[model samples]
Structures are given as C-alpha cells and as structure tokens.
Target: MPTYPLLAPPPLSSGSPSAHPPSIVTSLVPPMFNAQAEESPKNLILKKVMNELDRINNGMNKSITLNSPTINDLEDCCVKSALNCFQSKVLYLSVPDGKLKKLQIIISNELHKIVNRVSDCKPKELEKAQCKPCDSYKEVDSQTFVQNLKTLLQKIYASQP
Candidate 1:
C-alpha cells in the first residue's frame, strides 16, 4: 500500500485575481464581407463548390474500363449532379437578389434529402466492356452531361470587369 502525502495546495477562491489565466492567444480577425472580400478567403465556400464541380466534371470523363465503375458510381454521379444543381442556383445569389433567409441552410436540407434516399445500397456487377469505346470516343456520361452543359452555360454568361 502506498502512503499519501500530507501537503496539499490551497483551493483557489473565485474572487482571486491570480486564479485567472493570462490570455496569450491571439485571435485572428475574420475577413470583412463585401465586394473586395468576394475575392478573398471569404469566397472559400465558393471555391469548395467550384472544386466539387471540377471533381464531378473530371469524374465524368474517367475511363469506363480502367475505372471499372459500378452502379454506385452512376448513382453517385446522379446524386452529385442533383446537389450541384441546387447548390449553384443558391450559392451565387446576391443578398439583394433573393428574399429567402438562410439560403445555404435551405440548400443543405435539399441536399440532405437527396443523400438520404440513397443512403442504403447493395453493390451489383456492371458490364464495362459495352462502354469501353466511350472513353476512346471522348464521350461524356449522360449521367453528368447536364451538369457539364450547365457549367458551359455558366461560362457563357460570366461577366468580366
């Protein structure tokens, strides 16, 4: 059996100044949200959206034979396409452009519904040889073709200074 030491530190009183810890941590100031901040880190969310779009666009062109895609891939592409459609429609809206409050939250709920519907699945074998020529012909998967067209439309409508 080990013996306990008799000496113990006094309990801190709530009123004592020394009881408070020195705050040496510096808090970073968040970038101001305005027209200038539009191009700053404030637009990181927008960048995330663009990155997802790029990833989906790239995935659409992946070689069917090399990738050996399953039905899950097709379902994923469709789900992503639907989500992006909702995201793009709301994410770019200026405050003055829409009367809806918490547009992001609204879009989030819509995306959640899409995901929930496909939450459970069993993988099944898919025939890849039938689509092998698609990669060679630079064919886009119809599953993601609408998104591709939407992206091109966005590019066409883009404004510059």
Candidate 2:
C-alpha cells in the first residue's frame, strides 16, 4: 500500500482536476485556512456579477417605459413580463439546498394566509379595487392544468428508466 503526507494526491493530472485527497488534511495541516489560499478567479467573477446586478437593480428607470409612446399604451406587457420573471425566478422546494425548503414553506404559508384573508371578503371590496374574482380564478385553473402536464412528464421520465 502507498504511504500518506508526502504523496500529495497524485498531483491532480486530470483535465478538470477532480479532487481526491488520499489522507485527511485536518490531521496533517495546521488549522489556518489563510496559509492554503490559492488564486480564485470565481470569487473575482462573482464580485463583478454582484456589482453589475446591484447597478442594474438600483439604476433601472421605470419612467423610460412610462414616457415612451409605444410602451405607454403597452404597460400591461411590462407588468406581465415583471410578474413572469418573478414567478420563473422563485426558488422552489425542489432545489438541492435545504434553505430553499424553508423559503418554500414560508412562501407557501404566506400565500395561504393571503388567500385566507381574501376568502371572506365582500363582493363590494373586490369591486372597489376593480378586481374581479374571475381574474385569479382563471390563473388557478391554468396552474392546475400545467401541474397535471408536469406530472405526466415526470411519469414519462420515470418510464424511460
């Protein structure tokens, strides 16, 4: 059998350098992480991305669309796009991270609370807001339709194995 310490995990000859440390480093190396630091291009790239996102989020002007003649009448398109982006970007429970489950549970419970709040409302309340009950009713029916389609797709995927 091969020895440890001086071996250095075969020098990572693979193209992607799949890490395969032979012996545990915790037993050998000192507890200082700063001494083992390497150049992390990913950290630099992530910092740049975060800076760009911050700039975009803070600098975006809604008045650009508001003042434009073409989009002035097409405000509904902008609203729909914003709502679609929100829905699409929601990190669902199916994500690999455990924290997403907490967020999912919180969001699910909050939506339930919102629905419960509105469930006992009078017809006049909806009418005053110019909101029809049928507006969200259609969305609910469509959501169910899409969910059923997704279940069918899951079944097909399972059958492939």
Q: Which candidate has the highest TM-score of all?
A: 1
Candidate 1: segments with Cα more than 4 A from true spot? 1-77, 97-101, 119-121, 124-161
The regions of model 2 sitting more than 4 angstroms off are: 1-96, 118-121, 132-161
Error of 1 at 26 (Å): 76
Reference-based TM-score, model 2: 0.21
- Which lDDT tens digits does candidate 1 get at residues 96-139? 32323244345444444433433232233223222222123233
Clash counts per candidate, in order, are 0, 0
- Lowest lDDT sum, 10 consecutive residues, model 2, at 65-74
Q: How would you encode candidate 2's per-residue C-alpha lDDT over 107-155 as one tens digit per residue?
A: 3343333223222335565344442221222222222322322332233
What does each candidate score in C-alpha RMSD? Answer: 18.3, 20.6
The collision pairs in model 1 are none
* Model 2, residue pairs in steric clash: none
**Alpha-carbon shift of residue 96 in model 1 (angstroms):** 1.6
